[model samples]
Target: MTVLKGARERWVRTGGTELCVAELGDPGRPVVVLVHGYPDSKEVWSEVAVRLADRFHVVLYDVRGHGRSSAPRPLRGGFTLEKLTDDFLAVVDAVSPDRPVHLVGHDWGSVQSWEFVTVERTKGRIASFTSMSGPSLDHFGHWINKRLTRPTPRRVGQLLGQGAKSWYVYLLHTPALPELAWRGPLGKRWPAILRRVEDVPGDGYPTSSLPSDAANGAWLYRDNVRTRLRRPRPDAHAHVPVQLITPLGDKFLSERLYDELEQWVPRLTRRTLSAKHWVPRTRPDRIASWITEFVTAVEVTGEPEPRATGRHAERFGGQLVLVTGAGSGIGRATAFAFAEAGARVIAVDRDPESAASTAGTARLIGAPEAWAETVDVSDEREMEKLAAKVHAEYGVLDVLVNNAGVGLSGSFFDTTSDDWRRVLDVNLWGVIHGCRLFGGRMAERGQGGHIVNTASAAAFQPSRVLPAYSTSKAAVLMLSACLRAELAGQGIGVTAICPGLVNTNITATATFVGVDAAEERRRQKRATRAYGLRNYPPEKVADAILRAVARNEAVVPVTPEARGAHALSRFAPRALRALARLQPPV
Candidate 1:
């Protein structure tokens, strides 16, 4: 656990706009960028960042006009995604230039993360990403997933909520009124205005003791959201592996909103927390542990070959377990879990530190052996090397878990060609590599091995929202089933884990349009809260995988909701389709 020691805080200028910057941990280590929700400042992540400083270089910033950052007179809708992305990238330039950064976002920040995950070029620029309570813009586009109960009351409340939460925008469209309000009428009514939109936890914040009886961060909401909503979704994003965290207790967004998040980044991993919308602040330790586990896992997948047995009939004690993107998230968790299960873990990841940490942790946990190594799951040569290395060391793989993946969450239009290709690379092609390289050997040797591929409940639930991601997961599910059919004859078991929400970091790795990472997260949080969602534990899913392997089951739905979705997908396809649409936008 990270103790609440001292953390560095600063107000810095990137462009013309200024931002509140809070940094902790060794600057040389990987940077974890933290973005807060609306009406909150960088201060919200203060205690959390200090704790995270123990393992990583944590960076938290208040969006322009929020927190301690200055609000230039007549603040431009400068909070837009492009501007915000630039601000984030600029932070990277200012702080950690040589190394890629890791991102952690909640609410509006998730939206920006959505954009971050879609571009191929940007893929090399980031190590990993996590989103909490954010929706993909293309998925969240104005399709209106609302169900208003009371006609008159609902209508009035909706209008006022929109206006109150977003008053600064209309104020910005015609800056004069906002200026007057900030200087006059609005100042007096700020209390009621702030209360209408942003929630201040009773136990948190000293603002409750202030006479003003309101928050100053509303400007962030008005300026950022109003601007993002106006622009068309961005055409592409830097394709980086992503993790999304959906809080089941969030009252702002619905679970259904994530029905097709994979369509956004195809290589997505979904994790839903049992907590409310305030994950970064409220559950920072858990969040940090999850990321640390994930990044460490990614690093461990790249280890060197251990000492080999001279000549054994079957060296099951040290078998090869090739896991893609093994440096982080489920892959990391799965890798660690497998090592603990008595298999020599071959942790594969693009990041060296993450891979190393994963292997290190697994070894520390008393795993007989663990190896961390880097390899692009999509690369034929890389995967082939993985196969050859395993073949030479252990002679045969007892288990192969294709758990490495990425998240795509933007709309079809917002995603670029690069986005599509990257999704195929890690999500589809990565699996293709694993199956072709690992499965072929298992078939040739006439020995059985369990292959478990991670897919989302979205696989069975058709989603056009995140077209690319959904399509890829669907392909994975299909491929897994098909491979199961062929390999079962050889006594090989293939299982597809269709998890609903397991409360991981996939949201941070999502890509969407228009909004920067922060704004996107806000919308996602809002939409999740508006609807009800349920999340499960990754350990439970891991247990399911182990059971599936032992039983040679075809499919494993990790959550109760997932089990229901799985049944509906087969027995009542129409009802499943209908239910999927009920979710808020991605």
Candidate 2:
């Protein structure tokens, strides 16, 4: 009984063993063959395959000695890379005889598929390769050799880190002990272990054949790992376009393993995920989406997906990002920044037309997908509904920017309670709603994400004319700091971005408390003029926001004045307090 429902299952014979192959989608469409890793079977790709089935001829297969596939007699020499390659070719030939197939693999499957894509014999047969959580044994061998021979401090540290992560690989190579454990308590508890440690959903996966699969698949390491790592082939370069999806939180593999990989893969597109290993199960939607994007791009252009040219493109590419107040100024600039990095952008703002305009331009810049969502961040009900819709439609956000805010001006004595409420509602409470609603979803997803809250220089630099606005922003800054401390354990980073007097439309719309309508308009014009003289663009502040998220900075103060104020508030609070008494011209 296969775990994959509605899949057409067949058996392909190779090297005196039978392999279980399952496929879905139209045969005439481009073929996408998914290979499973060790200690598992074809069922591992069930989630990803179903998603890709609509767009491709999705294929999955159990490697020899796993699942329903018959184990080779004397498993010692049975599961060699050469044999696995043969099994892959047999499946490909059986399914898509004349046409080349897009190849995707995870873990051990990725390991074997590396052999498939690199070897000359199967060059023309493989159109493209997408790898996750696995490295080519050959490249890995060279990586180890390079570090061992040179031994720099950073290199040695990376070696040590990866050595610790590969403890299970060492254990797997041990004799009948691994087999005995897998056949007994370890097999029964494996599913629970995956759920607890990796946050893999407790769906009915791994199937009932886990014990036999684990026991038999032990030969994958026995036959290949030692020999390949010790005497790795130098010519094991990938002939096909490669898309490498590295799991940042993979316990068994270090991110540094793929350093300088460009030398081996000529056309490489790298992506990172803040997830534990077994991404196929945990991040199926993302995985499927990336694969579809890569395959479609390749099919249409007859080449790998063109790499995004933006800074941190590798970090944010294909990641889902939601930005509030994306209608204009800093919010719109931030949205464009993420879009330029190839992130999927959700341009959210209270202004429907402006949001839609931002979203449209975002797509043109570089975002793979962009959408407009109109919602007032201060309105809790509207925010709640927006969160629900975003999660349901767009999946969990990889980055959230609570950038929506309003400005207010007037002395504390003159500022009415209504003025304070208005400022707080749009600034502090808006950030609160965004974090509670969307940040909650990010945490619940269990995968790491980033939250950026738009604060202001007035948060740290006190001023007499902007009492209400300063209080709201000060609250936002404090809130961000507190949330950063709380969400740190969950791998979610919270940042407070304080921008000082950027040239934007906020000042024009800012309310002047305790002033007549004519006086308010005059003040707005004067303030706007003063800001225009400074002439700092919102794009610079937007760049700071992206950099802050990337570096996971605690509090980022944009512009020279903001940074100066931040420094003063930290080390010379008395001077800052003394300066707070001065009256502004505006």
Candidate 3:
């Protein structure tokens, strides 16, 4: 039988509003709220909710005036933020009863969720929030439009830039236009437009089921954007744990909108979907499994797992190990780990001071010689010069660790051309440059050396939110694999090291496309690092790298999570995808 709760939808009263909500799964379990987008209702999430019910108390809801809910007329003062937010609270209170709910929203639903989480009264009512195709309203503007691959079509985007490019909005504002449109050719156009904005075009949804409700639901546009906010509480907002998911081809909003959200919310996870705007239906299983994993990752309180202990026979007496982005995190740890093993280290970093610090530590650890150099990995000429110098001074490169990289936040379209180029250059091309310049010499000697190319969990798969970063890492992975196969006969070992959630400072080295020179400089000066929850120390990653070199492993995945990801890479692509989606993008 079709789950009764799946369509067991209704409206509930709380304070001055009555809002619609749909129930699914076990009400006794941890409550989760699923909110859909414009021209869609709670039913959009029905299939996803049914799949999630095994572990969660799922609540799928239509926003006011959508689905089977009451489409109340605008009050005398009209629709406002306070009113809409009030409606959100009413839905949660009714569905979740006394407890806080895990909230997930897509499109306009995400807009409402963002507002609700920012407000004092309802903020605490939420356990954690996941924003799909949305970010903080204040910061989204920059990340989306900066260096998008295709600039919005001038006619549509610019016309809409003035106010609205959507006829649905005209209907929503014209009182009866939407209802009439849904009954006519306009309704046929709705799904097409939504598909363009969402990513999955005519993927798998029944748009004909409720034409009238679909059209009338478009009224939310007029309701939220037209009317002024009823109340403002400047101090009411606080950063709650937030996860943002953006699709790469989402025509409506670019991923760049989320770049600064990490700054606003201290605890934030960001992800990208290689999808269209209609995310829930397009990648339902992946999205649902990710929700289950994220909601359940509670912190363990007792003793931490003991660190691994081992012995290696490899000698690092004078092998020069060049590490990049070495100021902090795994890169630093990797550099220090090599030094401790008796390698003559060349600690290279974008920051001279950071390089100096690593050199100082290496010296303290009894390294015969620890050289610090400041060079931008993205600069080809600089990298070339550095490699030549290393060959002249050290004579042999036992290991060349390409560990420099930058982080990009928000959607794929959020990045500018410059942003894309810079990330790709550093994360992908840096390794290429390092290997080409250094590997050739090692091969020429016939003695052989090892190359560890640092990639991320994101490397095996692409992320919706990080277009540039993911693209770069993916290229790096393929390149390393190609190199490994081709160079096997030469006795030179090539290893791709995919690390999961190691703490590092990557955001600081990133630059925005088209930013003013002064502004870019200012950004660089005050760059802050983005972090992950399950942070692994840098030394751990360094140890993994060294071990991989010794074992002649093709791919040295650092964490158990990375190992799991590698396993899933072939045996279970779908389940692996779901597991991969558990972590945020940026």
Best by TM-score: 2
Per-candidate TM equals 0.44, 0.90, 0.46
The candidate scoring highest on lDDT is: 2
Instruction: Compose the digit string of candidate 1's lDDT tens values, residues 330-427.
Output: 77777766666555777878888989898888776545678887888888897788678878875566678887777777667888899899887888
Off by over 4 Å in 1: 1-319, 514-518, 521-535, 583-586
For each predicted model, how many residue pairs clash, with residues at least 3 apart or on different chains? 100, 0, 22
Give per-residue CA lDDT, model 3, range 361-394, as digits (tens).
9877756578898888888899889888888876
Candidate 3, run of 10 with poorest lDDT: 299-308
The per-model lDDT (C-alpha) reads 0.65, 0.91, 0.67
Candidate 2 residue pairs in backbone clash: none
Question: Weakest 10 consecutive residues, lDDT, candidate 1?
Answer: 307-316
Q: Is candidate 1 or candidate 3 better by TM-score?
A: 3
Report lDDT (Cα) of residue 1, candidate 2: 49
| lDDT computed for candidate 2 | 0.91
lDDT of 2 by residue, 1-586 (tens): 4569999989988989988888899999999999988788889898899999999999998888888899999898999999888888899999999989999999999999999999999978999999999999999999999999999999999999999989998999888999999999999999999888877777898899999999998899989999999999999888999999998778999989899889999989898876779998887878898899999998999797676688979779998999999999999999999999999999999999999999999999999899999998889999999998999998999899999999888888998878777889889899999999989988887667999999999999998888888999999999999999999866789999999989999999998878899999999999899999999999999999988887789999999999999999999999999999997775
